[model samples]
Target: MTEPIRISRTGSVETWTINRPESGNAITGKDVIAAFEAAAEGANADIAVRAVILTGEGKIFSAGGNVKEMADRQGMFGLDPIEQRWAYVDGIQRIPRALGRLEVPIIAAVNGAAVGAGCDLAMMCDIRIASERASFAESFVALGLIPGDGGSWFLQRAIGYERAAEMTFTGDRIDAPTALAWGLVSRVVPHDELVSTATELAERIAQNPSHSLRMAKRLLLESRTGTLESTLAMAAAMQPLAHADAEHQQRIARWRSS
Candidate 1:
């Protein structure tokens, strides 16, 4: 059987596919969550891996939590309400937390349907690029549930509060064009070109100074919750490190030549 996530490396970029195409790439079990967490941790430790691409096998990106599992009251939906609460904390929630700590930037090459937790997964990435065939929905409410995997936080940040609220309340799906209009994804590509486009973008990003990329990503995330003064102070602190990095000289040389 295939793994829950198929991981492959090409030079400075690594691609991770949510491989459960049979279930629309839903977070079917602990294996999916664990592997995702492991991948983030591994990427964090590996300095050579500067960027990551997350997509899914088959047509669908991810259906979020498995609705069948939810209906059957299995997996995270196992046992009672109290059990489910801790399950979120211990299970699906781990993905965002692990990813938040990742030093490398992630590009979500959303391939197809991204519903419920699936949508939230894309939101967690540093950058998002969608295929023309891709669709996103904060669809937890349709199941009489809320985004248990932190979609509320990530979604609003991606497209602001009002738009995010509308999507969450109605559990409505928006197509790639609509998503681009709302500033959710940076760009949309032909379905066939999604991977190639994303690879080009990721490689371009990876070619930059590694230390600066990580530092810049951290600053961007922190600034989301930080005040202007604090953000500036943090940036001040990090600037020295970036300047001191060995890549800085090579970058300056390349810049001067250009």
Candidate 2:
């Protein structure tokens, strides 16, 4: 069997594809978790990797959790509820944890249906670009399941509490335009142009000095829950290090000459 997650590099951008197209990229087992962890590790270790684009292969982005696994109580979702809880903490939960620590920027290229866990995965990324064919749902509620992969934490933050509440309660699929209207996605493009557009955006971001890029991402992530005073303090602390870098000096010189 081929690897469920495929990594490809182009310049400073790393692209991760959820490769189980036949099954609609249904997330399961250690493959997805290991993939996420590896992404974090590789990006952190390599200064050249400045951005990441995540999407699924073929048509469907992801069908969220494996329904067959859930039905049969196989893999992570065993017969016991406690076993399920442990599975979440040690398994799927690792995706969010690893992603949260990743300092490089990530753009979710939502090419098709991003249901349940898939939707949450997109929310974890710093930016999202959706194809016209893309759709989304907080769909676990329909199956009597909850967002076992930090959906509750990421949803309200991305689209506000009220919009998040509606999606979670109803479990209704929302099209790409609806996602754009709700601020869930930054752009909706023609299906064929999705990857190219996302790649262009990633390349633009990657052109910046890697150290400053990482620091800027770190500062923004900190600001999510930080007060104005605390945020300012963080900026003050970061400024000295940024100013000391040769890359910042060169950029400053170029700005002066222009």
Give me the candidate number with maximum lDDT: 1
Off by over 4 Å in 2: none
Q: Write the per-residue lDDT of candidate 1 for residues 1-258, one digit (tens) a residue.
A: 788999999999999999999899998479998999889889888888899999999999999888898788776676688987887899899999988998989999999999999999999999999999999999988879888888999999999999999999999999999999999999999999999999999999899878899999999999999999999999999999988888998778888999
Q: TM-score of each candidate?
A: 0.96, 0.97
TM-score of 1: 0.96
Give the whole-model CA lDDT for all candidates, comma-separated: 0.92, 0.92
Residue-by-residue lDDT tens digits, candidate 2, 39-156: 7899899999999999999888888888888898777776488877787898889989999989899999999999999899999999999999999999988999888899999999
- How far out, in Å, is residue 17 in model 2? 0.8
Q: Which regions of candidate 1 deviate over 4 angstroms? A: 253-258
